[model samples]
Target chain A: MSDRMGEFDLIARYFTRPAKRAVLGVGDDCALLQPAPGMQMAISSDMLVEGRHFFAGVTPFTLGHKALAVNLSDLAACGATPTAFTLALALPRVDEAWLQGFSSGLWALADAHGCELIGGDTTQGPLNICITVFGEVPRGQALLRSGAQADDDIYISGTPGDARLALDALRGTLALPTELLAQARARLEQPSPRVALGQALRGIATAAIDISDGLAGDLGHVLEASGVGARIDPEIATNLIAGCAHAAAAAGLFPYEKLLEYVFAGGDDYELAFTAPPAARQAVDAASRKSQTQVTRIGSIEKAPGLRLVDAQGRSVTQTFQSFDHFA
Target chain B: MSDRMGEFDLIARYFTRPAKRAVLGVGDDCALLQPAPGMQMAISSDMLVEGRHFFAGVTPFTLGHKALAVNLSDLAACGATPTAFTLALALPRVDEAWLQGFSSGLWALADAHGCELIGGDTTQGPLNICITVFGEVPRGQALLRSGAQADDDIYISGTPGDARLALDALRGTLALPTELLAQARARLEQPSPRVALGQALRGIATAAIDISDGLAGDLGHVLEASGVGARIDPEIATNLIAGCAHAAAAAGLFPYEKLLEYVFAGGDDYELAFTAPPAARQAVDAASRKSQTQVTRIGSIEKAPGLRLVDAQGRSVTQTFQSFDHFA
Candidate 1:
């Protein structure tokens, strides 16, 4: 690659281009962009380390996509449309193959979402990827967790616990059917962000968040933000995990009442959990139909703070809330 | 510290705050921001890796400030007013003192520029800092290097070579006068970006770029972008270096053309270099007065496509055009 071109030449070759609505693109010292009219910019960042965020053996393509996807998930939770992004890649060396794959993966997503890759920096170090994404939402119309009110219906899109189970299967801690293994591996490799569902819920949903750090922990964020409580049906959460026997068996490893723990506390689901007012239920349904996104109402918001889980028999289920913790 | 909170809590403590024009800062999944009316958003990102951007022993405060400053320099080059930023920091371990100092230094510059720390992510790894800064300029008014025309007057802000001298002193390759040494150290620790000067050039400058990768290399960028050439006087560059020799001599370095090379090829000056039509020269001066910034006419754009350095006697000088190569 060095024989072909230098760093600046490489940047100009693959990264510099004008995008629709971009006031300024590459070649300038920085990019100047116009945010969508009447919209506020939604911004989020995520950093993936060599060992902490992914295995060292993971391809740069997956690494690049996942890095951007994680941050995009944040934008999706806020009902924002992806617009632009900056990347910071620290590498041990300039691996040509790695860069090609990484750039291709990043560009694929960027093009698909109409998000332009604007600015970035590259440096020498152990591999690390940091991506900051910008999105736009109508002013005063962002879906925030603070809007969840008592008695509002709580809904989640897509399946949870699968990604976590996939990780377990990868670690050889669990056995899975061949077809299930393929599905789990795919989920691990390329988790989808609920962008469409989030945008659909823009006006109708009272509050929303992406299930990143498991349902319980992420829901805790909503509870803290909205100053409310939630009583989720443990059976519903358990049944979600029971869809896969390997995950169900993994759940059996925990205490009897804690089978819902993985669904509630496991992270990296990248699914949206939202709250909608009783009056907007019809609108929410309409949005689900329009967006073709599944919306499952699993609980109701309460005036009291903290989370409670009830079994099918309506008995309180006591369980340990163990999920992904940054330090842990 | 881990005892206090997790990554999210740490972000809340250090990186979240209301910034100028920020509608919502740091609490939601993504920040909600508003750019100044009639202005476009200028965005830039820079990543600093340990042992690559700075020495491993450097203070976290200086590192943090430098990370933000480098990106702001890009905005300043574009004649944009710094508005907001997001930081991505990867560390091998949590060090509370380091975080405190780093955050304090970062906030110092942010507050001064009326920029808010809107969003960020923190994770574990070898120390890597990625900062994305936002600035605003009037619509269709961003200064671009591609706008430079042949026969345009070339100008730069402030002096060069100080940062290089400081780096030399820091590496023990040079000795300097005590006062000059302190000043050079300050240049390295808290390099001032010519934001006002860039903003002053908004309407007057035909083309512009920030002198981060030395005068020669960065000017080459403008030349290439504008499809023009430049003839810089070597004596003028040498004299500029001569003026800084007291510091260099005090730092125990030779007062020779090598010093000039650093000024011409050494990077990280964070000064603006721009071209302006003859008719706009007076207006440029008026803008300088209005913004309380100095504008130094350095050279002239030429019809040719290659860069040349000529002596007072009009003889071409042989000098290697070098700058900071990120990959190298």
Candidate 2:
């Protein structure tokens, strides 16, 4: 890769490989893709700027991987199979080592999901990475946030909040045991996109969203879009942040209940939060089993206008949750 | 569309609209598009950073217009039909006025091109705008730089160097009469994309590229890709600068010859540079007539290995052109 070389040279060296899966790839005025017959193209974009989205001294490899991963997460939420992506990058200066690591990290995830780097623009500016990913789903079968029904059960794939816990640990607001810290840090840096699970659950999933700005906030989007409310089980929700007590103990919390905040409100988990009809529970379980991803039914959609937290016995709880807001 | 408001609310208020063309639109995990049958999807991305790409005093409306325009220029170069786009914006704060103007400018051009705002991400950070545009072309019909051949006529659309002259004027490096300055400034802030001309040129223009980093540098890309050289006519190239003679006179140049630099090396022209076989001259003229855009033949492709500048006579001219370099 020509990271430290001239900008066009860098693109030629790294981003300009021949278009294999793509109808046309890098080096043209634009890249071309051919979606499968009778399919809809799913498109999503995400931007990450240095010092805001990432800490100083973070490796470029992690930055590249996370940049594309975030956009892919949106595709996974829509149950689309990854196809292609374009990157627009602004670099402070050409650093060969950084570019090599970054491109390696980027291509690893892209190749794993069969996503091709189609076209991109690289320029001289402050460090920023923006990626737009494209995927495809069968017409009328793709999942969406507005399709949830009042009686549908809300489920999340894999785990949530570990990335937030890692953020908290890095910020020194919380202390974590070695094992937990390592696990959380990994999640923070390289959270997996639930693409296989999302595709597998397509028709079975009534509505879907990737848990990003915390379960409380992101689910709020589902509620807003689907015109439905939700009542989440706090007991099961707390289990989502299992083993975080070790971190709370390390921090010497008096009530030891602060761990619950991460459970309900921590963002960046990159997990899939979907709703499925109760009658389709077997199908949902089967899809999750096929993808080898753990599916947790943590709540039920309701006709009410807002979200709620309930005790295991179904009594209302008085806990407030916060969503991660870029502005707030 | 959301320039200054709270991110999600801003999106809901301004960008969340029903997709008349897209299968899915805003408020979902991803927006979905279905290319017409037997068509390939053409995709391109561009990133514009505040200060690096534009002056601070420029309006959000102009910023919005230019961001999309540059990407559309790529579509024009590829002879792709404008279809859809995604915008990822980073802003410092929510300013209702700015968002309104920006969205207004953005939509004006979008509607004119029939391009839909598909999906995007908005976040808090240093001000930056990244857009990825999608288009469509019949399979195997895309105009590529690599398709240019020896003996092809090299052509450009509209004007070049006016934007660079505007840039120099903004930097106080040149002076111009008010009328001249205003015209140049319009070219800088709101250069039009030759979308129709591009679509019409398909199957006629052998190869094409958009003049972005200056004719000299951008044409270098086409030449490098096509493995051919060029001999540009100085008389015709000089006329491409149009009314810049007043600025050169104001700058106290002997016989006002400095205008040539702006013609050859000035960047941000956003015009098309294309190649066509001499035999297709009649068809090229018909395409230009159909698109109602001016097309100029400025040079000829050659079997030689480097670009050469020629006088009104056939002999070569000893001259130099400077490209806009971000790092330099």
Candidate 3:
């Protein structure tokens, strides 16, 4: 960096562009944006640390996508439409190759969702990525955490356990066949935010949250927020893993027991877990079809006090499960 | 960390509060907001890292204030009214004292500006605080960096060199009287953002920018964005230092030359540097008076190609500045 190595030139090279949707972009001290008229803006932020959130050997391309993806997942959980985001990145040095790969991945996903990059900060430090995303929902139309009612049908979108399996395989805690590991690894690094499904469920789902800190852990947030408990079917939870049904009868990736452990307790699956009244079942099915995403009915919200997983005979079998926590 | 020690509990302990202005706040996937009708939103992000941004021994309260203040300064430059913000923090461990101090500092400044913390994420990792702020400006009325014209009267808010002086004193590069050191240190740690001054200058000022990374370097951004240049009065620049006039005639903190060096090129002064056409001089003076901020005329924007500081005799004396670069 030189007296002549101006910050604007660096930002202009990597981050600046014509304001397509925003009123102003990176050259200004603050970016100017106008959310679509008469809409409420949905805002969320998430930070990714180099070591704790990802392996040091991870490429910038995947890291960039994952960072933005996680924030988008939060927006997805809110039943909000994605619009724009800002990235605050700390880097050890200016590596043009890294920036190139990172920006490529970032813009690709951003463009796909029509979510523009508005503004952010770049600083010198160890690698850390934080992104804050903004989306919009009609006023009072947002699906909230407190809306789940007693007897609401609890549903989850897509597969939820692949990412955890990939993490375990990478950590050497589990071994996987090459093909299965590649699939799981991709799932871990490039988990898609259920944006369309969330939008579809807006009117149907009573409450929703994206699964980040494991199914049981995230569902607990909904339970606490809605003042309701849930009874999940253990066999259904195990079957909810992607391709688990096929793998179980053929080349099982892990024992049924390990699969259940990863499915219910492993964190970082960017899928949506939602609650909708049973009366909206047809609407839920239509939303799933419209979004081309699968919706699985795994349980129901109850007026009882605590979350429980029931065996096939409806007996509680929650003894073996442990929820993931950030601190303990 | 155990299953009992979750991220949500920690968020509630420190940050979960009913958002008075936000449509939806913490505990949801995304906080919801609506800027006043027909207004454009101003967005900016800033990240502070341990060691690089602050000393490890720095008080959490001061660190929190500085972190949010810097981002607020960005909105000030754009003449936006502060609205709300989201924070993404990573911590080494939970220290309740640190959390209490940091939250108090953060809330104090935020409340003073009526900027609410709507939502954010907290994770266990090395300490890093990244905040993204949203503000609002009447549509099409925001101050822009690209509007400066040649020969516009250049002005700066308050004194710009105090923070750098405090930094030098703290680093043992310079010795200051005890009382002076305390004042300088406060300037270094709690540089108030010129939010009111910026908002006041919205229609009157031709271009504006917050001087954080030294006057010349940051003003360089305005010059580049507006496709203009500048000629500075060297003596005026040196005299712009806080308490310099009083200190110069007494036991000096350092040689006059060294003081000028810090005044001209030293960074972290959260002052506003802006330009107004000659026709708007009266309006500029009224704005300064209304905002209660000292606005000093330092130089003029030039049609010439690059920035130059001229001595009393009107020849170039800008050779000493090595404009700081984060990478360098």
lDDT order of candidates, best first? 2, 3, 1
Instruction: Please compute DockQ, using alpha carbons, for every candidate against the native two-chain complex.
Output: 0.69, 0.65, 0.64
TM-score of each model, paired residue for residue: 0.95, 0.95, 0.96
> Quality of candidate 3's docking, in CAPRI categories?
medium
Error of 2 at B67 (Å): 0.7
Tens-digit lDDT track of model 2 for A31-104: 98999899999999999988777887887788778888888899999999999999999888888888888998
User: lDDT tens string, model 3, A5-36?
Assistant: 33445576777667788888766899988888
lDDT of all predictions, in order shown?
A: 0.79, 0.85, 0.84
- Evaluate model 2: give its TM-score: 0.95
Q: What digit string (tens of lDDT, one per residue) describes model 1 on residues B1-328?
A: 5554677767767777655578877777898888767878888888888887788898878877788888888988888998888888887777788888898889888777888888787877788888889889999888888998988988877667777778887888876778887876777778777787788888889988888878888898889888899988866665544335434643456855676676687677777888999888889888778877666776788999988888789998887866778765
By DockQ, the better pick of 2 and 3 is: 2
lDDT of 1 by residue, A218-326 (tens): 8888999999999888776566544343355554544534346556766788888899988888998898888787677788899989898876788998876865767
Which 10-residue window of candidate 3 chain A scores lowest in summed lDDT? Answer: A241-250
Q: Tens-digit lDDT track for model 2 on B21-121?
A: 88888778899899999898899999998898899779888888899999999999999999899999887787778888889889988998999898898
